[model samples]
Target: MSLVPTVHLPDDLAAALTRRLAATAPTEASAQVDRLIENYRGATPTAAPVLRDAGDAAAYAAYRMPATYAAARSALAELRARTGAWTPRAHLDLGGGTGAARWAVADTWPGESGPRGTVLDWSAAALDLGRALAADASAPSVRATTWTRAPLSGAPELPAADLVTVSYVLGELTPGDRASLVDAAAGAARAGGVVLVAEPGTPEGYARVIAARGRLVAAGFRVLAPCPHSGPCPVTGTDWCHFAARVPRSALHRQVKGGTLPYEDEKFSYVAAVRPDGAGTPPAPAANRVVRHPQTRKGQVLLDLCAAAGDLTRTTVTKRHGPLYRAARDARWGAPWPPDDQPDGVPDSGGPDREGAV
Candidate 1:
């Protein structure tokens, strides 16, 4: 006879069970777990892979995973050291799925008499995980508060905070949503307050981070880390700066996904924006000439109107220059509107639109 080993839930799971079960009888909780197991057993094998949900069993399991917490702690430490401020009276974790950011923040500020934190996410499941982590840390009294409301576009009308963090959440938003989140984060930071925004290190992810950086800069935040005041992201288009993180798999997580081992791969990037004490107004945009790409049959050019910064860079494949240039231009500035009726422009040899000069 062959024996299959039963997988045990991670410590965080046990803690969550203990907390939630505290309100209910152990027998009842066990029965509920059994029922959940049975439900999973009957689930169709062909079911689609679970999508990432804000507050779900999978998200909770992911938060409990060590890698996620470690990365968050590293980021927090870096931000704190750069800002030269130790104790924070209040902290806010935006889109803090499963309270991973909350756990990380509490751990980072251990034994510090000050600093209460609030974990805000759309999922009740995530809030439960946040509560569980807090309870495990044995500081539930000091580290209390969880917000289930979605973040607003402008400043959030919640409690004020000295340190605010938005981690691994911006990439999940649309462009407009990203802008709104950035604005809200800036507003949440009090004078001399710090706002840290982090995301995965993919092209799309970095692009979103860059967009947030722009908004933060406009709102009067200073860049604390990562050399180079401001420039194009260094990653190639296809490859991004992401890492593999291990997170414990729970029944809730497994029910949503199936087994676990290869944990989540989180691509992350972070920026700390701070408002200086007694600072009057934000600095003006950099006064650098927008570097323009030399006119080439196949090259991309990006123009920054505010800074008058432009650059023309060669692309991997010359064939993509037209589309890339058009995209770059649209991204930096609004669509170019040419005056109607002009000299007969030479048709683009490569395509219908390529021949015209803008």
Candidate 2:
């Protein structure tokens, strides 16, 4: 499996963060980061804003933003691969504290004018810091992004947009609120729009994402990336579908986390669904999706896949398979199987169950 390159913070944003961190004492920032970690670990259905002040917000941006940005980028990449020629003109990011999703969107479709972006969150501190960070962003979209204060409970109605993103926010909402928020997103998204919900890769996070996926499908949206079919998820019991994004750690991130590692892999579960309102041709789903990293040993490669037939399967490719084996050797988790460039007319190697399952 190919190793995804470590995603780094944009230079402009990195400089902005450096300037913000320069004013705060390292020890104070470190202390606040520890508190944030504690809060996040047990932050389900938070009654109030976790970021209570500028200090807290700044600490969070320094520590969590890079990882969140990476995860969002990975999910967006998958969505873009499936939605060819579909560029969103407007983007709505719900509960987007530091505007990580907006950054991901802008990076995903660069060179274009970029989407008109708006980030809504309940925390004034987070909004303020996000605004400051985006004020001098190199990307025009980021510089022109709007930050608004709003509750996560889907009150006052959300603004209509071509793209809606809910990332790392569901865990902080009650069950009722989570459903309400997703419904609101479905209601506000324009026809042919896209809504992506992402969460930490933990089993609980996967549960939340899966629930949201069902809600979107019920709302008439078609499942895109991650799941090859709109049918029931084949992953059952102890197994959950998830992907990982490697994020390069900034100096402040290392200091705040107190770790020596130069990078961290942020595992995430996500579902990208589109409002198939008949504006364009309905895209075809992938033949299969790589659910796990391809495991290669000797002349054979073992692949765990979620097939379009609505099942989880493990297939093996031996050296004798020629070009197919080469493609298998280059396969990466979360990517479509038998990539578009692979030699045509390759025989099927995806039947029956193997020793491994995802």
Candidate 3:
């Protein structure tokens, strides 16, 4: 018996997908279809080894929540606008979770000219959810094609495509696994292909984004979004850059959390990298101005208020001293004094001024 029960697709979606499958089969598409079927058959409701609880249907549902899908759609739209007139015939969605990204792609790029996608994830339950969602969409008569029971560690040889999407999956992997996945995705992109990677907004998540950025850059990928490529992270390197978005949570999520509104606040870092015909080197960082500080007094330590908009502030250190350690670590003062007494009225200058010394 399978750990997860068989997933049933909505009649309309399933029928449409079957019709589309018939058109692509017999020679080239047969093998792909068969592989997908076999994988789905082997996938049980039970979770994979990597997840915390393979058998917890509620947990699986939360994992495949709809908020993620909406975000993926928004990200894809942003990518399409930036990448120009490139259209995809096939799509590979790594760590797709519930196949929300796949369904979003189908819905956004519908019709005969729209692309076909392969939803890849380690969880069979998640894949099952993806199939159901794809079938539910009002897309053209096309098979909601998918392959389950396939782990990212041993992903099958994938067909090349114009676009590839890997959203909200890198954080789960160890550093080594993250690197390997990126290398594989980059290698799989055809000439003039684009890859979109999205993750939660957190300091660690941003670090992963940076790592991905480095790997993609080294592999000759050009960044299309998020300007000022090289600089101190806006979040002070404490968290990733992210925003809040509204989306429907899955059935499992509702059952587990007992909430109806599927909206979520996710912190994410994303990048759309493309292999251009003749891409140039990344731009250099901009220059900033420097300012000097005034002299210190017996009771007052000079502080460089230029950076703080010329507001001389004082902070006391020892119990008997006026202020210390503002300009430098080794700074000390005998007592407290006003800011005007210091040279240039700037703080932290080392000049000797004994007049009105504390």
Candidate 4:
């Protein structure tokens, strides 16, 4: 079952971060944020820790964790929906500074005692802040997290777990390290294990996600979201596949970003891959995915879809088709097509392409 969408940070985490930010001089915190932004935008692999000190870690947790948490929540939501009845008992968050992905996981699978989490990162400061914040978390999984200081180099073999997530960390790695990390992530998937990789929505981030997707597929895993088929991505040229998660900003967030908007949309690209369980089969993915926002015109709705046939196609539904038209109007971007109705996989009417009809 999918959990409710998380638009803001959990109250406990938010309060803890605010307290930490308050302890630091506002100027110092803002400066730390600026430096982190520059480093992240540079997207260069660093030989040393990015969050070099407690101030840097605290500022980052206050400034970026909400967006990272929201993006991870959205990606994991897709994984949950795609993998029916499959629940993770243990999770490993690779390069998971401050355990943002772990927070998302707790929300995704609430009330379950298991899915005990481990957050591994090279930055001791980040891990320390993360541990402090999680100590008061609402989820047992978050509170019981094992905060470990580990480097993401050498493509070291990882411990097998039910779930592994690599979020927003690929950009900081050299090309060789990035591939090695993806390989390690692939190898970490055990019986029915799932791997999720997320990156910024930038072109560079999309390239990283695509490369990881190829590696997972080659490793005998089945893709479960965004892509309806495991074949080559139909998205070509400059167009990239990405999704947006809206995060509510705190006052501190506004001060750091100099933005007045109460919420911001975090654009991210991701892929969720899974291995077969004891049944020796995986759940079926959607027949098609709404790759972009649905466009509604005077009398028709246009849906840009990644169809099950492993190709990009446009489906148009007009007023002539009453029910389907309404569904198309309500359809959201990044959701499966046909609106989960018509479970038989046939629409009320469609053209020869079988995408949709008037």
- How do the residues 1-358 of candidate 3 rate in per-residue lDDT, one tens digit apiece? 2211122233443343334333332333333333433543453223343332223322333333345555566556556644445577778888786665676676556676577777777776656545654565666422556655566653345557666787878866667778878878887777677777877656666677778877888888776544223322333324344433444443333443454564344435666677665545422211110112234455454432111221223333222332322422232121112221222322354432223211
Worst 10 residues of 1 by lDDT: 334-343
Give the per-residue lDDT of model 4 (tens digit) for 77-176.
Answer: 8888877767799899999999899989988888858578899999999999999888878787899999999999887778888999999999989889
**What ranges in model 2 sit over 4 Å off?**
1-5, 154-156, 343-358
Which portions of model 1 miss their true places by more than 4 Å? 1-55, 62-67, 140-142, 151-158, 228-266, 278-358
**Candidate 4 or 3, higher TM-score:** 4
Candidate 4 lowest-lDDT run of ten: 349-358
Best candidate (score: TM-score): 2
Worst window of 10 by summed lDDT in candidate 2:
345-354
lDDT of 1: 0.51
TM-score of each: 0.56, 0.94, 0.58, 0.93
- Each model's lDDT: 0.51, 0.86, 0.51, 0.84
Tens digit of per-residue lDDT, candidate 1, span 245-348 = 33445444344445456444333556666776666553222222112222333354333221212222222213354554444433211111110121121123
Candidate 1: count the clashes.
13
**Model 1 CA lDDT for position 140:** 51
lDDT score for residue 251 of model 2? 83
lDDT of 4 at 266: 86
Global lDDT for candidate 2? 0.86
